[model samples]
Target: MSEGVSIFAVGDPAGAQLNAAIRRTLFVLGEERSEVWNGVLQAANALRWRRMTQPQPRQFQTQQPLIDDIVRQAKRLRNLVSDGALLDLIAEAAVAVGETDSPAGAVLLQSIEEVGTDGCVVVASKAAARAGLASWLDEIGATVLVPSELDTVASTAETSYVVAPPSFMPSSVVTAPMTPEVTFVMPAWFGNRSLPSSAFGGHAEGQIVIKSTVHTIGDTTEPETAVAEGKEVADVYFPQPVWGTRSSGEREPTSDEVEACKVLLAGGLGLWLDDGDRIRSLDPKQPEGARVGYEAVKGIVPGTYLVLRQGETERGAMYDRAVIALGARARGILATQARWKARLDERLQLIGSRRAMTELERLGVRSSGQVRAWADPRLICPQRDADFALLLDWIGEPSHPTYGNAITLRRAVYKASADLRKELESAVGRADLRALERDGILHLDLPREGFRGMIVARVLAKAPFTEIVSRHHVRVPFTDGSAQWLD
Candidate 1:
């Protein structure tokens, strides 16, 4: 109260990534080595965590480690469009494929555009009418574009040439010159690039240049020219938006209100308990038949006392608290009487993972409320040690439930662990983080007493959020390079 109302904002915690990195570092250094080189290891671990939190792209002159392995995987998984690689391809295409007039090309580009390249992309082969590929695309929620309707297939080229990332095509597809026409030309790496093509295999060759894999149809003379001329392609990504609510504290009371509260709080509304436990009123006009003077003391007060409302004063707040408690008890009793407990339990059962729910039931926990008691975030992510396997085994087994829900809850925990790991490993962009922080501040509805004029005006002047202040609406954008509105 003395400090007045202070307004501060915060977001979701950020230690998960750092924590995971520390664990990894500890694992990498054996216990004996870790203890001996603890100081050096700790510094290195911190540096690694910082690097992960604030990621940047490296301009390597040659292929980095495992670049070949990555290319191999991409090639294996490319044509298997349903294997969660289409989205990445679509993203690359949107950023790389500038403008094309061909209908089939337009359609292919439009598919990525409609979803906005930030999300997953669905694609079908335009060269040959492959039912298997079409069905697979459909199963995986991607749209297949056919080239026949476009008449864009070249006269000399029997197969329509579509450009995709090299990583997404098979080695055979990458090396194949033309089945009458080159079916597709892929950037040796997982990307989209302008590639030369010929119908009769005059000068077509697939080459891995520098760090990327490229498939070409026409010239093998300067394969390196396939790389973008002016602008460098970067792999750096931004952080996700982190918005949170902020509330200000209450205002300080005036001297008059303080005095009033004191009077009202005295034995509560002029009713005091006697030695015999009898309730007595202080108004001094008790009627003959009235237990407490309801109508006897009506008209004599003239600014000599206080007026208390349940919402505004201590004495009235006491009664309010009693009423709320009674109401809660009554509601609980009514719910039990009406046999609604089972329905409520059924409702709780629908939250969280299905497998977790099943496991909880096996361990005699069937309700949402019960699940929370056992779902401690710490236990979900146990500490690492030589007994790590034993601990994990114990956690995986239902018979030895350390925590109430421990036996039934490893997959959900594991999935959460994996997600946190991925988030930690990924690069978070500064722009996205700034936008989210600014938006969260704008979203706040500060109490008049706590707003502190300078702060509000400063925020409004800085961000683009002021335009929509009247609407009280906001949209958080995705951190992906593609233009996308997350929510």
Candidate 2:
């Protein structure tokens, strides 16, 4: 909401901007010469943590095609990014767990079971804590993120498995077994899709969730015509058997279609959609009549199209990105507002309007944000105290959190590079220092004694902002008569 605060500003957080994060790892490795530097790194990582938690889309995602009756739809990979990275390993480094040799590591993969991909990355612990000659770091009992949080799609897939390192070999232990409820299989994406909830065998708990954008009030969602107006777009694949036929007849879900199959708006509510962008209702139900919570209205994707009348389109793509970035923060407001609106409407239907207005105003909660910020736990919730918490979780907020990076970059640099590379990195990055070097006021120097005792040796320094820009160094034994140091 501030100036220069657009999605583009999110910038690659994994870049040099994250130097502080790297330093924190270093500090944990027993490298500490400056406590002041540690404090700075702490704040920097906190900031990075925020942005890392924002609900951005996958950086690497392919299309989804599981329409064939033979190619039963399994869990998608795009939704795995939130699961964290997988551990990198080699066969030699493998260890045994619980008295078993060649211990197969486990992972906690999270996702919606069907949309996009999860970027929960697979990573090898760089830590030196090894069990033995067996690359101890790799062989230890650890939880690896299958797809890595770097991946956005893999985390949201319906069912995640605690797969072993090798793809072919079956592990002795798997989080999800071959049981019916353990494995989910959804219907086809397009072409006369029809199911009776009995079609998915026993795993009928799957529901296709969708966040549609609305234009007009009512329209048809027939796939036969180019602009088939649908008063509602029904993702009826969930809790029921339904088929969707395409206009051209060539069909394969891009990604969202497959995920939507596992979700159903509550009470058989229907959504109007043409290209996944919600239009309005078709079953002749008032806005107050529809369902509530994430089961009813999920969050929209990044590039959803609206008003596809062969010309203009909805510019909500930015809103989509912001919503994704703010994640549950934005969704919390929507869900709470929807639930509260339903409650208010119900109250109004029974009581006088004047009294309702007075009650809401008395609580200092005239808007959705106020409702979202309600820590009181005693608000007019539809259910119990955790109603607010549950609503936040549905929207991906009040649970997982992340923060902006650029605002914290400076602080991180100050922490990690108290006087090391960051200080020099900034020294080189700054215009004034660069000018000083050119004008002979400052010169990069490598002490004749090397890093053990080195200085920038100011020649004609004039900037009075020296409090933040000073230099110091220390050294420790490295090898025979040699040493390593950072200033």
Candidate 3:
């Protein structure tokens, strides 16, 4: 669409030859008019006519030629087409007949020679095909097979690769009697996918074949130190147990607690605390004032201690009002319960000494009925002038003549009541107090901690081992701090 960019030029012999090869290969594969063929033509045309606006200085220039771009695009095309063998043949033909005088082309040719054609079959899912995996295998000279055709050809094929989305069952795909290696390709920000060893084969150990050259999105290089490092990967791709504990002391978490954590994570809510400080630092947007205190789930080694906030259950519609009333009643009952009990105990002690009745008579001659009423824990009443005077005299506090002023007493009680109510409401509103009391507020002293501070963390931290919503590849971090894109 830009200046100097056009369809494949007609006059250039090398470009013409490359275009002819592509056309012939597509035709042989019955894909000449397919989207794959169109995409290839557009990619090749774009690269072949890509012109540099200005010549770089001699020192800055690197030996990147049109052939290299052709190969790169060819590899990417594997995901677009179903027939990788033909696509690879087309790419090889293009490289062989196209311009190759550049030093980079010479090196590429030599590398291709070293990686001699070794015949292997690749069975890829539709999702993997869209991710360009088939093309990549084809570029490496592997015969890519559709799932249906695998049953017919698998017995005779040597070394089969089964590539599928993380949620797929590898055993189900390769039902025929042949040893197959599996690779899970997952995309960015995907959730609810897990890779269990059981999927490979029951009881028998299956080899995990990892390709070092294939890189996916959000991948980073491995660190070269012994110290722990955090490499953020897509939440769904992180393969590690959710670390948690029941108490602040160091202890292992029970299976039920772990499952609860998984539920909380699935619901996309929970608190994540850093290991050292026990502070909420899961937010990436927050400024880095502390040293690296959080380790990714995949990088957590056994014996490391971590802190975590407990997960909350789904509350009923009346939860808020019920908690408020509970908190208010608790405050009122607790405030007087201890004082009332102490007063009763003291009265009993005095009665044993035959001084309680004398003291009661001195304080306005209280009868047995009055004593019984005052001692009742369930009797909640407003402070009256007589009661206030009696309490002051009984407690040996000097009574003031103006103590019963109506406005003063009203204002004092109103302020005290308001303050107490506010304090209780704030405490109850911040967290589910009932849940916290029933199922401890936080889990501490575990090996690893995850912050449910953001949506991504919640989806990943304790996601269940269930079917994936979508398919793609992601960079996975290991316990040793090394990482690679598992595609």
Candidate 1 lDDT score at position 209: 23
265-333 in candidate 3: lDDT tens per residue? 222233221111111112222233321134444343222222223332101111223334455454544
Which segments of candidate 3 are over 4 A away from where they belong? 1-118, 125-131, 135-141, 146-149, 154-156, 162-169, 172-234, 238-487
Better of 1 and 2 by TM-score: 1
Q: All candidates' lDDT scores?
A: 0.26, 0.23, 0.33
Model 3 TM-score (2 dp): 0.18
TM-score of 1: 0.19
User: CA lDDT of 153 in candidate 1?
Assistant: 26
Better structure of 1 and 3 per lDDT: 3
lDDT of 2 by residue, 47-86 (tens): 2222222111222100011011101211121143221111
TM-score to true structure, per model: 0.19, 0.14, 0.18
Estimate, for each residue in 311-333, the C-alpha lDDT of model 1 and write its tens digit: 12222222333334444443433
Candidate 1 local distance difference test against the native: 0.26
Q: What local lDDT does model 2 show for residue 227?
A: 20
Residue 221 accuracy (lDDT) in model 2: 30
